[model samples]
Target: MLAAYWRGEITLRKLRVLIQYLPEDSPARWQATDGRPFTIRDAMMWRALWSVATVAQQLAGKDKNAFENMPAYPWSKPLNQNTYGSFGDHTPEEVMDYLDSL
Candidate 1:
């Protein structure tokens, strides 16, 4: 996954799919200083891939303008927030902070 990001082969839609599997508080959950509460290398990998996907989207001339019209989580709704569980709103900054924490 990291290799894909480094090679800029990811897509925004795919990136969103990856993000859906990451924990809401992945950073705080995986940090060594946070007592290694949970293992989250996979989340970190996806976050890195997301960065690459953003770059790829820009290079392909399908930048923010393309995403602006898309709904949040355009490809699919988060599983945990679907009919089985209550939905929670989170800002992009919060999501990034979680990824960075991991």
Candidate 2:
């Protein structure tokens, strides 16, 4: 869905509930209460990615003992908060910038 938005296959309003991405100088941009230059679509993508990373961390932590005890070559543990936390460090703007680069 996010890719579709970037491809212009979907409008911001189509993917999101009520938000629209308009020009910075457009009247619609000023009408928003959030005062963000972009629309909810970008926010939603950031939130969704963050939520996924958090859930992944929780699942990894749930089996902490099992992962720690595993005898894998090179002696590395499974994924944990430390591995995924960096993903959450990115702001919505940074996430959108990355997506745009793709």
Candidate 3:
């Protein structure tokens, strides 16, 4: 999916909902929200990635910022907030490179 996104197979909106890749993985993932895994299941991964996805969505929207709050789920809403917190940073390109490396 990450590779697909990079290759322009998928839009930023889909990518955002799909992943963020967290951290603390025994084996790093290529498609991470913050640091989750190859697949994104978390609402909140990295704010940086969020920022990128958000911007792309907004730009593609009828009006910029329309979907500004694209993946506005409680990233670090609660339960995991205490332990995992919010990832808040990372780039898709970096993740893509990582995936390629693997």
Candidate 4:
């Protein structure tokens, strides 16, 4: 997915599908620091993907957007208000470095 983002092939629709279609017990779902699962509303990767997707939509100036009419999870609204804090506040280069270390 990160590779797709860098290659400019990532789309909001795809990201939404990726998030929405994951099985409830899939290990790919993001986790909290203590290893608990994140509520869908508070999923960090979802928020980041949303942020990037919104930016893409604004840049393209499209009348129709991917997320505008999509179904949402029951707990998806009025988000958890940053329960994970801001640990992902790195610049693109910094993020690349962090990813490299993994």
Which candidate ranks first by lDDT, i.e. highest? Answer: 4
Candidate 2 per-residue C-alpha lDDT over 1-102 given as tens digits, one digit per residue, 9 for 90 to 100: 668889999888787743434444454564543443544565566556655665676687643243333222222343342443444556767977998999
Alpha-carbon runs more than 4 Å astray in model 1: 1-38, 65-102
Please, what are the lDDT tens digits per residue for candidate 4 over residues 1-102?
A: 656866879887787787778865465654522344556445656666766776787688742344563323324543333343333445567766887999
RMSD from true fold, candidate 1 = 21.3
Residue 4's lDDT within candidate 4 is: 81
Top model number, TM-score:
2
Error of 2 at 72 (Å): 39
lDDT winner between 2 and 3, please give it.
2
Which ranges of candidate 3 are over 4 A from the true structure? 1-45, 62-102
lDDT of each model, Cα atoms only? 0.53, 0.53, 0.52, 0.57
- Candidate 3: tens digits of C-alpha lDDT, residues 18-92: 665434342445234444343234434555566676677667763244234444333434222324332334455
TM-score of each: 0.27, 0.28, 0.21, 0.28
Model 2, residue 1: what's the lDDT? 61
lDDT of 1 by residue, 3-100 (tens): 56557898766776775677645664344324433344544664566667777877976544433333222234533333533223565677669779
CA displacement after TM-score superposition, residue 66 of candidate 4 (Å): 46
* Best-to-worst ranking by TM-score: 2, 4, 1, 3
